[model samples]
Target: MGLINMATYLDIIRGTYEGTSEENGKRLRDALATDAVWTEAAGFPYAGTYVGPEAILANVFHRLATEWIDYRATVHTYVADGDRVAAFGTYSGTYRTTGKTMEASFAHLYRLENGKIVNMQQFVDSAMVRAAMD
Candidate 1:
């Protein structure tokens, strides 16, 4: 008989953040299911539901990389329930155009299936993020 292997939802979600930025990104992209959907907060600049890893990279992560300086999401806590995991954190960055910095609380809720993230929704203080931009 062969043993079955599995990773808990918490472990899968936590692995996405508890690594170097490059590593984290790689882990995140690797963890996304082919048809995964990522939602950005309504008031945020990239406010839309992006589908698939390529779409997410183009719509969100690539913009963040190009538009901010020293941008970081510092996760403070994580909660896992069933197939959902929530990460509570603070986002800090300096807007490249305005040269202003802001820090705001943020939360990300993720739903997983078969060890891959199927959906993710972000909650953040868009005003705080916009303050830095303006």
Candidate 2:
């Protein structure tokens, strides 16, 4: 199947966090290609370029699972152009260490191929996240 458009992509995003079930995680994982690349914005705690699904799972998802409580991305808008999708949203979470809740606007850009995400780049307010964690 060809890569999905922005609406379907957003639906997939919502499905990932709709429940605390392994099925959601599996769905999210299934959308990623093995050779996918994820780039986290610099200055964030887990900032770096993660290559491949395993590396992304370790560096990005693992950190989110450990460091934040009730972490959620509330998408406000989506724009799609061919296989590229842009999602505008806010990340809301409580920093596990400080117990301080924070909300930061973010833009996530994704490139998909054959219904799988091949690359992603995230933009967010690193300073706000740092302050929340402090």
Going through the candidates in the order shown, the clash numbers are 0, 0
lDDT of candidate 1 over 61-109, digit per residue (tens): 9999999998899999998777788999999999999999999899999
Top-scoring candidate (TM-score): 1
lDDT of 2 by residue, 72-111 (tens): 7777777777777788888889999999999888898888
lDDT score of model 1?
Answer: 0.90
Q: State every prediction's TM-score relative to the real structure.
A: 0.93, 0.85
Which stretches of candidate 1 lie above 4 Å from their native place?
1-7
